[model samples]
Target: MDWSKTKTIFILAFLILDIYLAMEFFELQDKSDYAIIQEATIEERLAAEGIEYPDDLPDDINNSFYITAKSKDFTIEEVAKLKDQTIELPNVNFEEDQSFRTLNMILDKPFPLPDVNTESKITQFLNDNIISGELYHYWYTDEEMNSIICIQSYNSRTIFQSKDDHIGMVVLHLNEDNEIISYEQSMLEQIKEVEEKEAAITALKAIEALYNKNYLSSNSQVVKIEYGYYTHSPLSNQQILAPTWHLTVEKEDEESEDFYVNALEGDVLQLTE
Candidate 1:
């Protein structure tokens, strides 16, 4: 056996292995650097355009999925609980599935709401007067409609609704005197999280997506950001909802506008009939 030749062969093999590993390490480092550069570039560009967002933008990755649910039906037994309201359920299918999408009510006497700190008053009213009120959270008031909107939620997450579509919500009508008048409610039932839990984009990424799509206006301030679900299948009987990012932008002397972005795909979403 040639002892010297064997030793030389072993050294050559180890030398080749070391070179390969070093090259792999450098490649990974380069890729990481490129990612950081790309993110920094986005930040700089946004500043240049005068687009303002909150300083505490979330970068945490979360898991979510597509869900399926149907509108809930209101039974005669449920409405019987209301003590001081004239009730109507025009959308109920009593014969078969007993499913409904809307509930209407008119207060027997106008209930006055206070001018200051009306939030606690509203919460008390819901618990005392409405059915399944625990499942909903206060949303916003629509001055044009003269209504106060409360959104239905599940598992600490809210179900989003557009102006055109009324699902999983309660609309409380208010008269000029800040008194309760008539109202309508909609709800969802049999909510099943269907697809596998998938990764969702962060708040920053969603904002970037809106800017890239030209859905965001220049010199606008993002006043609100919310994580919720939106129905992608509006016409289907069993609707499928997607995890969404809702961004509200406000400009001086302009009406605030909402833009929803699909969290998984980074696409700006709009509701269709």
Candidate 2:
């Protein structure tokens, strides 16, 4: 064998191997350093005030982390407990106007008649009945223009067998071209002034029936209750103050349960059970 030739070949092979190993080592080192920096940044931020980050972080970590970090006063266990207490709206019927056909009809055709005709009918109806209030107009866009002409009567009264009740709202809907589509009348009668206390009491009673029936536990505690007016066209002008109630109930496993309940006419509208 030629010693020089053999030595040269071995040296070149060793150099090539060394270069490959160096590249691999640098790649691994770069990856390790990147991971360390990321970890250190997270730890430093979380440990600044002894704040504990959530163990099972959500995929959207930036938003969740911000919320958790801002609520540093809460411990990890406290946050877990809070999460457990949050109620899921699994049984709520959130579908408003479940009959899509009704909605589709209004959207499909050009508004049937002129807005003036529909508005006049509504105004005359209110005036003849001596319903005192303001009238407003609204428009919606489907494939074509749709309009809603509304008449809202503030406070009024009626007598049914010597019983006096408050009537608070009246609404009318007109199509895009100002054609009458629908009207709604509220059942509350002769309301003098809309007071929160009166509305809350009404809401509580309405909610209680639903709670006892199927929406909530009989022993559920009503933590908060609020009531206010809600207007919906294609329904009635008689707007009722919708009452919302927040409740906490005890589960069989001793977990605290939280949920919201909307009660109207002895029926639960939206309930998280």
User: Candidate 2: how large is its RMSD?
Assistant: 25.4
Residue range 46-115, candidate 2, lDDT tens digits = 3443333234321211110000000011122322332112212234353532211111111222224443
Poorly placed runs, candidate 1 (over 4 Å): 1-36, 58-61, 89-100, 271-273
User: lDDT scores for all predictions?
Assistant: 0.80, 0.35
| lDDT (tens digit, per residue) of candidate 1 on 103-197 | 78888998788998897888888888888887887899888888898888878778888645777888889989999887788788899987778
lDDT of 1 at 154: 76
Cα displacement (Å) at residue 35, model 1: 5.8
Query: Clash totals for all models, in order?
Result: 0, 26
Candidate whose TM-score is highest: 1
Give the CA lDDT, 0 to 100, for residue 182 in model 1. 79
Candidate 1 has a TM-score of 0.80
User: How many backbone clashes are present in model 2?
Assistant: 26
What range of 10 consecutive residues in model 1 has the weakest lDDT sum?
91-100
Q: Least accurate stretch of 10 residues (summed lDDT) in model 2?
A: 63-72
